[model samples]
Target: MSYFRSVALGAAMSLAGVAGAAAQEVQERTMTLGHVVAEQFPYHTSAMFMKEKMAEETDGKWTLEVHPSGAMGGERDALDALLLGTMDFTWVHTAAMASFVPSFELFNMPFVFHSPEHIEEALSTLDFSKFYEEADAAGFKLIGIGSPAFRYPMNNIRPIETAADFEDIKMRTMGVSAHIDTYEALGSQVASTSFAELYGALQTGTVDGNENALSALNAMRFNEVQEYLTLLPTVANIAVLVMSKSTYDAMSAEEQALVDEIGKQTVEKNNSDYASMDAEALEAMKQEGLKVNEIDDLSSFVEATAPVREKYSQDLEPWVRDLMAEIQELPSAK
Candidate 1:
């Protein structure tokens, strides 16, 4: 009777241990993260790496379902969907975000970022807490920045080395007013062209030129259609990752910490990858026989477009002006 009693007691202790372990297990969640680039693009590749890390670090409690190539929708559409609780997260160009958050335009300001390193430093030291707070009020949260999207002018007309070359060139630009204002100030004929329609427009002479990050030019195979590329990366393609604020708020503290860590890790990795990818894209475009020219004196271009800065400053809200001042005070990219 004593031996049987000992056996039963041991069995009960083992079962209790198992039950406690199971009870302490982290909850499983499926995160849906989306980007506009195809799988081959570094944007998608970095996202995949981050997702893998998130799942592994959390012991498979968090698995990500990535949507690439705009399968979810355009960047703006994804932003809207996030508010409706249909999309959980997105990484999109800052230009696409400017419509929803006007202050975002500062990132895409012409000649703002001198290099990847410059922008990377700005990312760390810049005070975007206000923007984050504003995002929360509007149902979204700005988590972190992504990509080294360096924008340059690609055209069917001629190689552009100086602002003078822009005279009357029909340039395709995003619907962002700053771009239109900048190009118009430089004497280029600006027209809004959706990314999907740009290739056809350039091929058929509807627009003589367009400016985009070198990665985009290579990814979209624009070199095959365009004859010349201005090596001036006028606008850095600033991108950011965002999530639904309400959803984020609802997560457990531990889960929220994991999300924040993952976002930072992903941003750092993407910036490193973007440097190499941008170089490769430029080389590929050159091999494809696109004439590439460098602006010997960018001051000429800057001087010609000064009014654009004034125009924006005179009209923007007071807080935006203060934000721009902070950026201007940062050290230029080395």
Candidate 2:
């Protein structure tokens, strides 16, 4: 009986050691997050916030390494890396991500949101279950999304107080079909330009103008090149944080919960920060000598974009269209 008791104690000790080793291995795993935006962008702040919170909540069990300013590569490359499991995560504008996830084009609908608040309210209500299901099927996971403020036209040539101003203006775009068509429909000659060359393009007359969130515009220092900003039919932006589905699934249940909680906190912080950054950017741009004009007749721009939206809608999936309808009906914050 004494020998048997001694043997049982030895087995229990070995099992406890094995469990401790497994827990240590789980805690030592590192996650890599990549993004194309500069550190000046609020996205970077949010990413770091998420990283810190994750490390704290997990008791330093997981550490996140962030790569900003396209250090890893472009957004598209990051998405590919996520699928290949070379990158654990990436954050990118849904507009740029539309090529990989066509349903994301739903956010591109002009005049769908009035302010960041409206977009957030809709996001809080609209079911993204399908998006996750689809992303998982494609080997990517949609972890969280943030409202990226509103997009408006900024030009060097003239104030776009009216849709007529867009006539004959050459605008740089991401070369997405919907974006190109939207500008063309509104009467701008669209130029598909690289992000790295956008400032040079505006300065050298390669394109007269472009549209983006005010924060992003300032982050790129477009205020240095672009002289005029026309706040028109505001377009909303969604920044999606993506990860490899397999990578997320492989995390221990506790680790996954921590990640999810941190993701939600990141989304909230980024969106609210982006919303406030818009006003700060406007003030900064004013100080930078950019003439800003508010379009009194925003309805005109919306009317002009009607055909573009209709054309794009024709190709969108049914659920995407339904999602668009829901988003358009969300309470406005104008």
Q: Judge candidate 1 at residue 18 and give its lDDT.
A: 11
Positional deviation of residue 23's Cα in model 2 after best superposition, in angstroms: 8.6
Model 1 C-alpha lDDT per residue in residues 239-312, reported as the tens digit of each score: 88898776687777666766777777777667655665667677777777888887656776777877777776
Pick the lDDT winner: 2
Q: Estimate the lDDT of model 1.
A: 0.74
Cα lDDT listed for each candidate: 0.74, 0.75
Model 2's number of clashes is: 0
Q: Show model 2 residue runs off by greater than 4 Å.
A: 1-26, 204-206
**Tens digit of lDDT per residue, candidate 2, span 1-334?**
2222232234221111111123444566688999988886767888888788767665577788999989999889999998888999888888766768877777777776655556767777888688777777777878887764667788888888767778989998656676677788788999878877899999998889998887778878998988898766456667888888778888776667656766777777676566666766777788888888875456777778888788777897898788877877776533
| Candidate 1 residue spans exceeding 4 A from truth | 1-25, 192-194
**Against the hidden reference, what TM-scores do the models get?**
0.85, 0.85
lDDT of 2 at 132: 75
RMSD of 1: 13.6
